[model samples]
Target chain A: MTTAKRDTYTPETLLTVAVRIFNERGYDGTSMEHLSRAAGISKSSIYHHVAGKEELLRRAVSRALDALFAILDEPDAGRGRAVERVEYVTRRTVGVLMAELPYVTLLLRVRGNTTTERWALERRREFDQRVADLLKAAAAEGDLRADVDTRLATRLLFGMVNSLVEWYRPQPGGGYEGEQVAEAVVRMAFDGLRSGG
Target chain B: MTTAKRDTYTPETLLTVAVRIFNERGYDGTSMEHLSRAAGISKSSIYHHVAGKEELLRRAVSRALDALFAILDEPDAGRGRAVERVEYVTRRTVGVLMAELPYVTLLLRVRGNTTTERWALERRREFDQRVADLLKAAAAEGDLRADVDTRLATRLLFGMVNSLVEWYRPQPGGGYEGEQVAEAVVRMAFDGLRSGG
Candidate 1:
């Protein structure tokens, strides 16, 4: 399908282009012109796929948020012992983030300048609170350390997880491998670097 | 020095307002007009203290970079076992981040959009590399866990440090201080939340 036929761009493909441009130019720095240029289409052509820039942002963050929130719903995440649930959420989160790298990367970088961004941030906080609750439960169950504040521990745990977007690049060779990295993160986080003899 | 005398804002005072705006609206989001409103001064008044927005950013990030780079020069940071030095830098880096929150926040948020920002990012990478070296040394000393890559550890460690900008608000009651937070960060980093036992 070329100009001869019909090569209609979907909201999904447009979003892929938009997130990359947003990451490259930043959400605020990007303009319709930038999106048009990156997408190989005219500015007017973009309105066909999505409402505007904000819609693209909303879609991108929504993907990331859904991926994150869905972690809470997973069987392993929901039915495990509190500590196991926390670890399951942690592992799947790193996997989700890596799988949905571009979308999650955009979500992590939002600054709450617009309604979409603020909504995204609120959802992020909600997600954090859910994790914090798990941590709290784990501590109460005596599965996790009671010495640390659950809130602080949750933040540091996600802090390590979310930092992946900053520097993690998927291998150019196929297969989308991530579990190895996730395993390392879990071990480094829960078990500490000190090897027990 | 009464109200009768002409009132003017010093560069230091102007920066406090400017950095807040920068952190909120982003360096690129801010305009001379935004600064004027935030500082309760005319747009022209801002020019008197600094050249323009980029100059303001350069000054702010320079201050932050200076503090971090100086950590490498400290006796405690430079001396002792590699693991100790790594811990020393982590604790002091947290303190530096908290003490110079606005400046460090500005530095962390800068993208390579302008010359000032690119320069700041380069310098930041250098600082990161220096810390990464400390992690490498600690790993070589067989102190750090061998399983996780030192580079990944360095990124996660700094990620823990840099995330302070996102949520840490200094207390109005002054009971919770930066040093206390820094201590907590160090404790959590070296020893797992599970405890020394």
Candidate 2:
């Protein structure tokens, strides 16, 4: 990318461009040239922003992990009944996923090949375990169904939630929203198909 | 891979090793050196077996696609009631996934970077549409609930099922077999968390 004298590129803006390119071209398939082209800067300018492509991966996954863990710190997530806490986290997760779509998409697609991917995988497991603990608490409190295993339920729930990254597209002109999707998810997951009426 | 006079690798056996490496290192991240090391052969010998990495990917996804489409031809899947056929397809899919775990795992991970990956993606959509049509048929028969969108249910069901590849490990000695797991999946997808009793 050709650089202009006026506005300097910070690591953050450069990273945003890098992550989008990483997603478009699978991370392994992307190169310094691709990032330079996508960022509208030279290869040297790209290196000046971040050390390399791996650094860009590290920064993107860090953003996703931070947002996910932050959900556990919210008041509703920490103080509610176990079932309610699960629901709250579920809703907030959908929001975080949409708000930080590129980062989370990168995090999800990681194959644990590099240092960044392995770290991302570990943090992702921690996030899943936190939700599993919430499910365990719900089960113990007699709120959730007793038949399905808690760990199984947690995986199934997150499987459904994470699947959103596969199909969810933001609306133009402010049409569709993640909140409505999250609410439907909670209802279908908690209540099941038998009609809770 | 220097082809020695005694080179004895078949396409099928070479494919097995190649697909495993592909899944572990990812299709794009893996190189000829990695494949040669994994197969315990020379880089040239690798080509004697399969054309290239993309060809291996095509072969693997073909195995997965064949197994999945074969489910549609089964008498139970083709001739039964819509709800029954849906359950049959779900059961058979779980079986196919377990039986062809590595292939389908690779198939699911394809991101459309190459012609083979794009082909896999198109076939995946076709499979999803077939299942969605089953859901539509069931809804038309007034057996399944109509409040929820059939397409949405199809996505969720496959989301949970496809997720098995991410985490499910079969017992090395003896435990639940494919049929039992398929039964549980069908049960969970249809009757759901409610007491089916």
Candidate 3:
């Protein structure tokens, strides 16, 4: 690679390339050599930025996990009735998934084959549990349907949110914004898809 | 291998073993040798059952697609109010996912790396479109909410239904039966998660 390109490569830039390759090829299927080739930098240059491929995986998922965990710390997520708080977190989560699509995609697909992946899985479950607790609190307040299990409801709600990674490509001309999609998710999820409620 | 084990290895049995391996180690990571080792059969024996690894993948995904597409032809799916038909299809789709978990899991995870995977993805899109049409018909009947886009609603609806593949394992004592989960899915999808709706 040219000195110009090599000089410009940073950990964040390298991570963007690495996560793309990881997502294209499964994490276990990718190699450091592949990352170097994709990033247009030497393996040594990659090592200079980080320890190895696992480090990159860790950084990428950590970015996603950090963003997700940060949502719980937001003022809206913290305040209001439990039902309102659940709605706020749900809407904010759709926004996070859309904003950090690639990183979160990689985070979601980890199969726990390695230490980094296992850690990512644990963090993901922790996030799920936090949300599940919110649903439980809502249920206790008589806002959530008592007929449905809160744990199951939590799974289905986030399931719909997480599936965006499978099909939610950003529009070319800003046709559908993240807020609009988030609104659609909240509406269908909370208000039901059928009309005449 | 024992003569008894070799004698009992039907094509159906072999597909079961192959799908397990493919899901554990992704389809790309699996080999005929891996299949042979996992199945307690020789490479020649595996070849005797199917032409190659891709053939096994094709068979596995075709089973899932066939089961899913068959839902549309059901009397319940075809003959009811548009809203009720959507609910029937949703509930039956959940039952199919639960009944055929491993096969559908493999189908959902295909990344189109091979021709078989590409074909599987195309059929998946077709299935999604069929369901979207059902949602559109329901909207025209004024049974679905007008505030949300029908196409987006269809995606979110099935997105919740399909997410079961990620986490809906059959309980050891039949704790969560297929029909029960289907009921839960239909109720949550059609009847709003919030209470007093």
Candidate 4:
């Protein structure tokens, strides 16, 4: 018997399937045929919802980029001390990554082989630069350590955060939540792995 | 006139060229023809050195995996206090990642769509588990913080380390070296981002 889940598919639903396929098969290796087979939809139906694979990629990466860019505009990220602002952005970035894990995973893996991929890479760099600026200001304020380079610290901090995509799988009734993970990230970034000072 | 570089293309040398292409084009997206064109050699010549693209992938990933596994067997990593051992592994991991950047980059991005990809992933997980065991022992020894889960901390630590693949480029006389980066990583990870902590 056919699954009832296949009865109806919107562009948004089609995108969810496409992104999963894209993640499984490297985006360069995936095609419309793969999406159609995964979604249990016809190629015409897939095209009817979206222009093509590139459009699906654009839509997927945009979801991740939009969520990330939004974090920079939040009052907490802008109205506080640079160090605090960096912390705020770091926490929210982790939250967004956990929330939008698949899309961001795809975003992080883009190789700049296509126009859509190149655009995603450029936007990601812009986001990283904005956060790097916050890190620079924190260093200038003497709130951050002098020994570690601000640019290197910024990369490491986000690297730790962006890594959630690699292994974090959400559970319906799991013990860990995004906020708790964010708290741990902030503590680790600010205080470190060792207990106490 | 042909460059002197083209004069010799041993399997090891050809594997380097193939790995770069595998990284640029996703492994599944790459083929014998792609490797041939990239290496300035014919498909037959490429085959003469290595069996196929998968063999090249195997060789490259084995290089990365071998380097990483060797770290666990190092005297410093084996004979220290749990905390110190973890630190040693962490520092050496960053060094190995830098020295084998392209190979590890391809290793990290493997999607597990093929048997070789799946094997690479399994070996990576095995390595992560070994490191995680070290982190767990450190926590049990009361050297690490109790607040953060050991598993979570292990993931974050490596996440920060693994991220070097995204942006690190080696220079013959670069301002930053792997050991320096490793020191900063250990500092940020053990001490943190705030000043005078």
lDDT of 1 by residue, A101-169 (tens): 999999998989999999999999999999899888878888655567777777778887888887788
Looking at candidate 1, what is the lDDT of residue A18? 96
Score residue A175 of candidate 2 by CA lDDT.
37
DockQ of 2: 0.28
Q: Of models 1 and 2, which has the larger DockQ?
A: 1
- Calculate each model's fnat, 2 decimals: 0.29, 0.19, 0.75, 0.74
Local accuracy of candidate 2 as per-residue lDDT tens digits, B29-64? 889888888777887888877788888889999999
DockQ of prediction 1: 0.34
> Alpha carbon lDDT of residue B96, candidate 4?
95
For each model, chain A TM-score? 0.93, 0.93, 0.95, 0.94
Residue range with the least summed lDDT across 10 consecutive positions in model 1 chain A? A1-10
Candidate 1, which segments miss by more than 4 Å at Cα?
A1-7, A25-37, A42-45, A111-116, A173-177, B1-7, B40-45, B174-177, B195-197
B1-197 in candidate 1: lDDT tens per residue? 11222328998888888899999888888999888887777777788889998888888898999999999999999788898898889889988888898999899888899999999999999999998898888888888776758776777788777888877888888544676677666666666655334
Q: Measured against the native two-chain assembly using Cα atoms, what DockQ does each of the candidate structures obtain, in the order listed?
A: 0.34, 0.28, 0.75, 0.65
Q: How would you encode candidate 3's per-residue C-alpha lDDT over B41-144 as one tens digit per residue?
A: 88888888889999999999999999999999999999978889988989888988988999999999898989999999999999989888888999899998
TM-score of each: 0.86, 0.83, 0.94, 0.88
**Tens digit of lDDT per residue, candidate 3, span A24-137?**
887888899888888877888889999999999999999999999999999999998898898999999999999999999999999898999999999999999999999899
Fraction of the native A-B contacts that model 1 recovers = 0.29
The sequence of per-residue lDDT tens digits that candidate 4 reaches over residues A19-117 is: 999998879888887888889877888878888999999999999999999999998998878999999999999999999999999999898989999
In what order do the candidates fall by TM-score, top score first?
3, 4, 1, 2
Q: Mind sharing the TM-score for model 2?
A: 0.83
Worst 10 residues of 2 chain A by lDDT: A188-197
Report each candidate's C-alpha RMSD, comma-separated, in the order given. 4.0, 3.6, 2.1, 3.3
